[model samples]
Target chain A: MSHIVVGIAEFKFAEPPHKLVTYGLGSCVAITCYAKEAIIGSMAHVLLPHAYSSSHDNEAPGKFADSAVAAMVQQMEIRDIGPSRLIAKIAGGADMFAGQFMGSDRCIGARNILAARKALDKFGIRLVAQDVGGTAGRTVEFATESGLLVVRTLRGEVKQL
Target chain B: MGSTPFLSREQVAAVEEIATIAAGQAGNALSRLLKIPIHIGVPEVANVKLSEVPALFGGLDAPAIGVLVPFQGDIEGNALLLFPEAGITELEEMLFGSSGQAEDDLRLSAFAEIGNILTGSLLTVLSSLSERVVVNLPPFLVQDMAGAILDAILGEVGTLSDEVTTLTFNLTGLEDASLVKSVLIPGSAGIELFLEAAGRLKTGR
Candidate 1:
């Protein structure tokens, strides 16, 4: 049976799965990595950029982008997924409530998107596609089997990234 | 009556204060900004009884407030913002200023925007009130049976048991008492700082 993994609040997974999905990504970003030949995939639903800065370390382990990405890559490597073969795609870095948060200043969504990019770059994973940064919150689903990424925004449109 | 778990006196007080401030600000802002007559309800402070909560929705057993569930996260030590489902109707009427059947997108968009405003407003207020408070993520807007909904949310955290204290409020939008937004500070973090602020607010410190 193909494994379907759901990234919980602080749960991070890297495995050869058929699909990885997370729902109700409000101000939380989900990053997905897939390797075609190996059919291995991993996903992280990160809430904060840095674990040390935010008090979320006590509650949400996957909240920090730095740690979450590191953890995701580590998981991928453990499953024999090579970094080079992995194509990266991301979604759900929506600013959630951007207008009231003063756009970029209080914009954690943009920050998450930037941090994800930096982290992926640091790990040598190429970003193939992204649907990030908007006023709307989104739910992202990744199909590791086909390496397809789909993003659905609340009260908005669903797009393939 | 099951006593919710033990939150430090400090944690309990902080919940009341933060909920008061958040609900007040969110309601006022939604009313002023959206002209929807959003009214923040009176704050009700109580411990989060996981057992009672299961009975609240449909008998979904959830661990602590932060535990992750099928689709949501920890829920035990979380606070709640409860609004009558009918309130949605009233809110639609007020937001539209005379509405028939509101479009699905319109309804969902309105909730999303309102959730954004509420979350942002609370962050600013808390930041101003406490030096230690830090908001990591934006508040998520959701609607479900109070129990199941909260269960989904609580599924992400560790067991909350009696550690979580909640402050609930009601809002009146469009003279029909519609819309309820809850700003929950989990029992895990943000509680102690809030209590200290409340003490200062109460003692005029």
Candidate 2:
């Protein structure tokens, strides 16, 4: 019944009876991977779609879609849960401001969503459900026991996926 | 985060001074609009890692209404006016003269206009102080988690540099005396030009 809070550009994993949660996902995507029989759950709050290289930079692998999905796969493997048995659910990737900024890439929310989907496909993980692409922010909670993904919007609307 | 400091102490002081002036002007403008006295707190200027910015306004999950405006010209950056959930109802009542109007588009538009005025006033002060032209884009509104809104704004800059120069303003004096915060994030090039201008103002060169 204990809850683990994940921050921006962060990730966590847990077993049955534990919950993983992340708050305020705007333009960023929160990916939750769980294996029901194995009682394993993993969550990542990804900030960007791709990873940038810098000599002085040491960023967390969970910060980008490509690396985050890969890292989650590795963590699940360590817990004896294979990629084929994992099911993923995602939420958040909101276009907070539309038509205000310059460039197509400025639509970071949409980009993050696409990237996460692509990464999931590359890893052969099935994305069972997602609530994304809107002008609102979302908070997500994932329970490992029953594998329920709960999403709450800023307008106080709740949906369980 | 990068170990190298982007702005020196003198530069930070200059930025703080400029922000203080802008906050004062913005406060006056807001007070006039709402017909209530408004007071501006001392401006806080600092270099913060993008990942850490959300913590300033509570946390990522904290519900808030954010009005974002981008300014371009001699100086380029984004200004954000953040209203925490606690005071949103009261503030809405004060602005629209009623409550339970959370989903009213008219009220939302009015709120955006208020953001426009306040941000414009701040930019005007900065432009006058730096002797440069700064123009603001239309202000847009977003009601969401503080972290999510900031991620959308700072995503580009986060890749270029691990940290950014952020100027924060705290305002008080509303009917409920609720605390409201405004954050200004200047682009790297903009900050460079601003520091140069500040140095010129200081040395009279």
Candidate 3:
């Protein structure tokens, strides 16, 4: 089995016997989309609530919540996977700095989660599970074959979503 | 290539000089507070594209403890200090004269003190350069995977502009000289504000 590493603002798609992983997700959110029966999946490391940079900037679409979900869905469609066939799960979005300079409503972590949820809804992708929002960082792995999202913290805490 | 040059040669030189000042003053403050002889080698300063930010902070998956001191005034910027897990114990031992178990609040405060001193010195030097006063806000202490902690700051600044001025220095004489990482990231706007205050920029007001 091989593992595909998704870097910050990067996204990758994979098939059976392959895993998608992202590390150290502080305020950033990682979204995993999978089609269980087909055993294909993708993951994105999203950094912001929205893409403010104009299209001229040629910025990575996976860097923002709204665009990442849309881009990931476009990838799924390009490979013959329908929106209904996709199941989504998200992790990360922790307030590592603990919300001082920004208010709770304005917190980036909170805003990222909100944007992710709204995007998933927009694409009609059902969200299965999530481990989001806190003061700790998270590293997540998604197994395409098993359709399991494994979330782990630096403190040795692990959860299978 | 589309936008004009981010900074002039003189302004970049100004940034390097101010960073050198910050590194020296922060090193001295840590040495005194920790009660250990400390050394700061040549400061490493860079003006990098924002896309390279994730790689700028090394050891993404590794655990780290950090302190963030935010400053506001003529310019807004931040100073971040990071230590390896073991550096925490070395800090505790050097700080209270023993490694015996201490309350979490006490340990946090002790580390905050280190942040306060180091950040205070950097802020002071920055003020000296701009000839404009700035104030240091309360410090934020965090312990987690290095990437995760930095992502919070990165996410905030990544959208602002494409250029980032980063300055880093290491503090030797601790448990591991290389374990201590101190960085200053004055975002693009902050850089313009700095250049303007220093009379190096004449484009806008």
Candidate 4:
């Protein structure tokens, strides 16, 4: 099986017989897109909300939520995968940085989740499922060949998103 | 033992200076990367209490240890920059741009670099201001704050015991906003440099 390691702010796509995995998600969010016709799927791990400028773009153009979504859409476009046909599944974005001593409201987890949703809506891709926003961390895996998503978190909790 | 207090004061001031520079540099770097302005601050001296950090973030079992930076002159006293559990996500976002599913060490690599940059930049500024100092060895990424400190650090350090205060700067959306400005200085280290720098700018009394 072909395995793809998606780095922070990075994204990739492949047809069947390939699997994509990203590990150690604290507050940053991860998104996976899949389509059966072309049998193509892609994933992105974003660290920030938006790309401030063209100068800020990097190898992992999908590192920011806004830009990453566009990056994924662009990848799909290149492969003739229509945006309307793709199903989106997302996971990660836990607040790994919580401390009772720092007070509340510093929790950026909720904000990350909200930002991801808002960004995805612009693309018209249906969000089929999500596992997000908590005090712990998470790891996510997506099998594009099967269109299955597995989310693992600190409580040893594993579920399909 | 007789010179412990004296040594403590000097070390405190040194750390304070480090904090001011670190705060400034970190704010600057993140601003450049995110295009959003960030501000950093440190607590003042009289308020540098070692026990306060654990008390503030401590559970019955989670006793945390902290590093202290004492302020000197316009920046007198110490301020504690405690890293909490929630802080991890913030750091992750700042470093990786998307907190994706990566191994923990890989996730922390970016933040460790940030801490390195903040600390390294602060040391560079301090070297120009007074005595030269370096925080050799990389910053250890820890899920457990107190446990990490006790395990990784050497010697003794203090904390910003009193209220935590932050200094903010408008990097964007401001007409006359200053770039290369000092954001915050705590009670620890040598904060007088901030006042000194401010006075040089005719913004101080």
Against the true structure, what is each candidate's TM-score? Answer: 0.58, 0.85, 0.86, 0.48
Which tens-of-lDDT digit does each residue in A17-109 have in candidate 2?
A: 889999888888999988978888999998889876754246777778888999999988888888899999989888887655534767888
Residue lDDT tens for model 3, A1-161: 88788887778899988889888899899998899877899899988888775742466778888888988999889888898999999999888888764575437888999999999999899999999988889999999998899999998999999
- Encode model 1's per-residue lDDT on A24-93: one tens digit a residue: 5645567777778877677877755564433334544465677777777777788777677778888766
Among residues 3 or more apart in sequence or in different chains, the pairs in candidate 3 whose N, CA or C atoms overlap within 3 Å are none
CAPRI tier of model 4: incorrect
lDDT, candidate 3, B91-178, per-residue tens: 4555566655777788777768766876687667657655677888888898788878777567656666445566666666655545
DockQ (Cα-based) for each candidate = 0.03, 0.55, 0.60, 0.01
Which candidate should be chosen as best, given TM-score against the real structure?
3
Per-residue CA lDDT of model 2 for B1-205, tens digit only, reads 3445567788899878766776777778878877877777668889887567767778787876678877889766676666665555645665656554655577567667767876787677667666788888887787677877777556766666667677776667745385455565665545765686677668775
True contacts kept of each: 0.00, 0.70, 0.72, 0.00
lDDT of 3 at A97: 83
Expressed as tens digits, the lDDT of each residue in A1-161 for candidate 4 is: 87786755568886778789776565567888898677788888765566545545443466567778888898788878778988888886554434321233333345556778887899898999998866555667888878888977545778986
Pairwise DockQ winner, candidates 1 and 3: 3
CA displacement after TM-score superposition, residue B118 of candidate 2 (Å): 3.2
Show model 2 residue runs off by greater than 4 Å.
Answer: A101-103, B1-9, B49-52, B74-77, B88-110, B129-132, B162-164, B174-179, B185-199, B202-205
